[model samples]
Target: MNSSWNPTHGWEDLVSAALVGTDRRPLPSGAATPEAELFDHAALLTVRARAGQTPREGRPLEAAPQERQPEVSRAAGDRLARILGGERPRLLTEWLQAAAARGHRLSPHLLPELLDQAARDRSIRPHLGVLAGARGRWLAGLNPAWGFLLEEVTAPGAAHETWELGTSGDRKAHLGAVRAADPARARHLLEETWEKETPQDRAAFLEILADGLSLDDEPFLENALDDRRREVRHEAADLLTRLPGSRLALRMAERAAACLHTENGELHIAPPLACDAAMERDGVRAKPPRGTGERSWWLQQIVARAPLEIWPRLFGRPPGELVRMKIPDWGREVMAGWVRATVLQGDPEWARVLFAWDPLADLLAVLPRKDREDVAAGFVRRHGLDGQLIMVLGGAAAPWGPDLALAVLEKILQVSGTQPWNLSELSRLAGERIDPALYGMAERLSPEPPIQEVAALLRFRDDMLKELQ
Candidate 1:
């Protein structure tokens, strides 16, 4: 090639020669053919183009903030690395909770991966904040993808700043923080911006209000029943219904009393004939979804939103007595409404009676943890491992105590012979929730692969928990 076939000039000539025929634009000297010469020069110019750029200075990065909380034990850190590396990753949440409870910080090198994992699985976000420490906060400050870590762990003062100026998610997080500290203050903050916020935001803020709900919040929520947005009105009514003394609750009680009453040891029913303006204003829908009769829908809503206390008073009997007694005509609708009310009111006595009437997972959630385990154990002993069983187990909190754990193990062994396929979800829950001390017992339960898998996870979790301790 010619001496002028340098990095800059050489690229220009190669492009011109290749585009227009070499006959019109003569090839630079070197190779025998124009094609050969063009290829050789192009290769040379590509390398020169890539390697010839002048380097520029980069801004200095600040060091990560100092962590006040001490790091987790070396063994615990190694286990965390393994969990993040994808060995029984579901245990990551357990590990995070354990570490946080121990008042330890996460190893700095592991923050990025854990943060990434948390971004995908939001259930872990709550545990991640305290354990992540100052360094994790620093990393979150640098990377917008992990910004949720900052929001989850923001200080009370910083929360107010975020509420004043941050994005929608940030504002919500701020409001949650304020609500936890002072429900009244949070309500006032929302009230100040009530008119300025969008309908969606109004609904979201109302949901936050549910955490520290009181009779004090009844007035604000009652007014919200007239919101232009359906969702905002719905949320307001839900909050009101939970407060049995609220005016909306009293109205619902009166409406429900009109529809449902008992006479001569048999329950009578009178479903609403029409959806009037008064009923609609109290947050009842004018229309029903497919397959549900409009009158039945109205009756269900009225019963569900009415105070649970109304039942015992009307029947002159305890919840246990009422739950066992069948509704003669509207059995499905009335029982379903009572279940909804039981959940909303969070009455343990009602939940216990309801669970006995029908072993439901939603009702299971309302029971205390010990009671939950006892109820689940009783159900497992009677019922076979099935979809509903899985849901029931899910409602109870983990490290499911010895009675429930052994009951589940016995069921696993029993089912292994006849219906092994059903063991998939049951075995997984057993491994995740069973107390780790039972690893040996679990291992010796059966030779089935599913049984063995549960044993292995139990052992792994045993070691994991010890390392944290």
Candidate 2:
């Protein structure tokens, strides 16, 4: 036998013998290794080894440095809690903006939740950086989930290096930061890597340009119209259309002018015979949907892309006056295309006038919130409680002003029994959008199924809004 012994090997042998049983495999030969003595010896050895064990030491944790900025007041902290708890979450943006404006730092305990919120709602990331301050950035560095906050907090001067060296997401965020500070620099940065970027990346980066978009970007955007990717070309065209004076818009205006002309007091339209290369290069798709004819599709694109001002210029009248005029056969098509263009360009005057004529949901959503509610109220008085009007009203801001809420209430009470199907969705909308102060009026309605349901929803929303306060 070897004189030097290994404790591990000895333990292994003892364990193997114990597992096989001393009855089947006899114990090792010796007075000290007797079957009855074997267990006692093993137990002694195990106790000695265990007692001798010592844990390895690790580095000590450092205390977090104190923040120099003052913490938000308890009232403000409670408000943030309500906002993050899903009570009127849309107000979170407003709250953060206000807090940032005041230079108020969040309570350190709230940093994790705010960082988590920033991760989920990327739209709030920029605002979060200011509120979260230095400590929040430190915490973000320790966790991958909160890593996105880093880019939003990075200084503009350091952004260039990060843009060149970071991952795709980092580069995009850096681009947005640079864009806000300097639009021209943002465009140049994108141009530097334009040829190297993938088609998908190029398309995504082009969309960020819309934030600070101006006439200065028209040349680069106009050149992007010939990109190999259809999405890239479409994005470029869309941005160019927002600039009414761009050459692309001029091209579209010229095409539309040719297709539509005023003869006598009426409008005459001859849709295009073919989608020529020049038209396609200007972002008109040659292929139409399966059910639509090429000519109608071409006409819609031309009208939609051309500047809304082009119409008044061509017809020598304001949009409202021209829209009131009768076209022989294509009035609906022409008006619909113009509505789409008005929405795309976000022309509030055109949207306001068009809403008077059509009261469409898309058009209503584009108007300023107060204007939207006011317009809906006018429409409710004019048209009464119809399904279409209710749908349009749903697009306005919530907790609607007294005039609009009262109009909606009156309409609901009038049409309660007649249209149960429409009432279901309208009841839900009422609950979400009606002013909480009107809950008493809503509650007084008879406990009929639809009325009761609407009342319950309204009361619930009222309570929810109250909690936020």
Candidate 3:
């Protein structure tokens, strides 16, 4: 009898009744969705309701159905070696076609081999439009690894294409990797397509290519500052601004130095100043500084152009003493920009001094290190006991480089008082710049609860040491 009727009993009651009847045949759960499968089992009914007709004895078996998409198996990728086994042209062309047909998201597991092998084949390469031209650039557009092929398939294929292809693959990865692996070679690759790409693409490509953005990349980036595209100009400007060590920064530093000076025991600068013809010749320009808030404009251009090194000397006689000096209302903001420049240059000593001036000074220190020691000490001194850093450094972590910074730190946190500010502010000052010495002093003077908890962490020394007795 075909039944098509609603029952007064709920699914659980029906299952219990069926269980009592001894109808033990298992339901066809493999074809059902998980929710439907749950309704078919008497065992679940017993477990959920805490009542069973017979005593519950065994754990229920998990029943997750296998997902099926037969055509796009991993083997579909591995079979490329044999599917067009003998046809060279067919082998090459078909591979590209297959990938194009697969839409943009290549099966994640097979993508590496697919990209390496497909890019090497010259004939398959010429037809690569199957992604850009045929697949309609949509697939490649979404995937940075493939989107890079835009210039490659259009240009000639050479072994050097590996560098071009490999580096361009940076779209998938971040600039940090490309910058780490040979900054010069990557910069040159961008230069080749500098004029050809759309202004939008050009700006973006340069932004990624901006890895290891050193003093050398300055001239070219400066040239971009004048590009017709505002975005291109802004990106170039943004990078130069970030580079506190650049020649542009040096020039701005000199200009800003001229403005700070003597007045009745006060540092003095009126509301505004123009980037005279000389400043403009040197790439510091202010257009009609009258109405556009000239003081801010002059300050922005100068701070952006100035090298961080000028701050201490420009504002006062001694660099160390400047730590105590304060510029009235606007001077601190103006000086803060100078500090950011110092941090961008990745100079520890300068960052240390600015760091001394204000605890919040740490934000400006977004630096990189050629040798880990530079940043490592700062990290340990600041965040040595921080849970995240401890996890990142691993178990055998011993301090390396500038161990003295920790001593400096121990003295600082030792200062008495309940964290003169906010808890969020404490998290910010952690990492390399944290001082183990200050941590020690803080512990010694007034033990914080978290500090005690951190001290209580389980440690493992060789049990063999105990066995020696």
| Candidate of highest lDDT | 1
**Number of the candidate with higher TM-score, 1 or 3:** 1
Each model's number of backbone clashes? 0, 0, 17
Q: Write down the TM-score for model 2.
A: 0.62
* lDDT leaderboard ranking: 1, 2, 3
**Candidate 2 RMSD to the correct structure:** 11.6
Question: Which portions of model 3 show Cα errors greater than 4 Å?
Answer: 1-183, 207-216, 238-247, 263-265, 274-294, 311-316, 361-364, 367-469
Prediction RMSDs, each to the true structure = 7.8, 11.6, 17.2
Query: How far out, in Å, is residue 36 in model 1?
Result: 20
A best-first ranking of the candidates according to their TM-score comes to 1, 2, 3
Q: Tens-digit lDDT track for model 2 on 112-160?
A: 8778777888888866765776677677666677877666543222346
Candidate 1 similarity to native, TM-score: 0.74
Tens digit of per-residue lDDT, candidate 3, span 35-115: 344354533444433321222359553332232222233444444434345422223343445454443222334433444
Model 1 has a clash total of 0
Clashing pairs in 2: none
